[model samples]
Target: MTDLILCGCGGKMGAAVRELASAREDCRIVAGVDLACQNSGLHFPVYRALSEVNEAADCIIDFSHPSTLPSILNYCRTHPGTSAILCTTGYSEEQTADIRDAAEELPLFYSRNMSLGINLLIELAKKAEAVLGDAFDVEILEMHHNQKVDAPSGTALMIADAVNEVRENNMKYAYDRHSQRKKREKNEIGMHSVRGGTIVGEHQIIFAGRHEMITLSHSAQSKELFASGAVNAALFMKGKGPGLYSMSDLI
Candidate 1:
């Protein structure tokens, strides 16, 4: 069995992961770290800080805030045989660098979004970019719940980057067109964000040409899909050597 430590156990995503892990026999949550420490009816011990936890966990699944990244990295540094699955988004550039650095010492699995279908969408976007070439203009549209703090969800950026990387010339991400009243540039990737209601998540990519348009989209019905992906990543990462891993790696 893979003994796990869950960070941000009090949050929605954390609770979903805990619920899914509870149903599985191969993994168990040994401890949880959360500022609220609300218990959320979990049988395992929950601490306000990672330093207070005494359990030795085989892996850690973090759905915590980016601010908690340092403490999580420190925990991994001190623990010899632990891997980490980071499912947090909206990290600053410095924090992102820290994650890459930490992976050199311990196994680390990181993803902007943890849904398997979303990752597949990224791959499909890349293939479409290659086949359609520069003749088609790409635009990514994403919608999340109003509670989400980040604009243009990370998954949208991931899809944009995947397509941009495959092109002969990297496409610039254009988040705003209102400020500069000008025609859309051919080498630019348009990104639009919508925040309203209780949308779990929705991402759609449109490839527009002169005559016809092709669209690819994915809608998440529930948060359980992301929770399931994180759990699967934790299982895949256990006992691995120091390295950086992504959802594509698991696929």
Candidate 2:
């Protein structure tokens, strides 16, 4: 079994990851680092910082906020032998570059969305864009809980970017719907967001044509799905080459 360390082991996603991690047979939770003590009744001791976890491990899984990057990258770079799964999202261009730099020598599976279902949808969306051609208009709608800080969720922009890569060069992200004198552009992908309820996450990609509309959606009601995917990624990254990877690699 591979020893695993979990960063952000107190948040909603962390609790979910722990619940799922407890049932796994391949990975062992050796260390847990979090800022909060609400660990959702985990068996292992959850630390308030990474330095408290004194032993080295095979891999580390991060589900914390983007602010956790500096220490994490530093940890990975210095630990040389340790690998990481970056499940945290919402990054600035500079921070992303820093992550890429860290992944230069260590194995990293960095992704905004880790659920296998969402990844499959991405593959399907790419195909739809290619087969449907320029006749269909692409629109992405995403919803998260009220506390989520990022608008249009990272996954939403990821899907829009996927479609845009195949659709056209004039693709633009439209966050609101206020204009009455405007029409949908064939090449532009409209992105929208909603914040309410305790929704775990929901994303829908629509291909609207003249006579028909095709919609593909992925609805997540709990973080268990994300936890499972993250664990799978941890398993997949073992013995893998040094480079940044996504869900596309596993799917």
TM-score for all models, in order of appearance: 0.97, 0.91
lDDT per residue as tens, model 1, 1-251: 99999999998998899899999999999999999867757889999998889999999999988888888888888998888899998888899898898888879999999999999999999899999989999999999999999988989988998998998557899999999888999999999999999999999999999999999999999999999999999999989999999998999
Count of steric clashes across candidates, in order:
0, 0
The whole-model lDDT of each prediction reads: 0.92, 0.84
lDDT of 2 by residue, 18-85 (tens): 78878888987888898877555677777887767787777889998888888777787777767789
Clashing pairs in 2: none
Clashing pairs in 1: none
- Model 1 segments beyond 4 Å from truth? none
lDDT for 176 in candidate 2 is 73
By TM-score, who's the top model here? 1
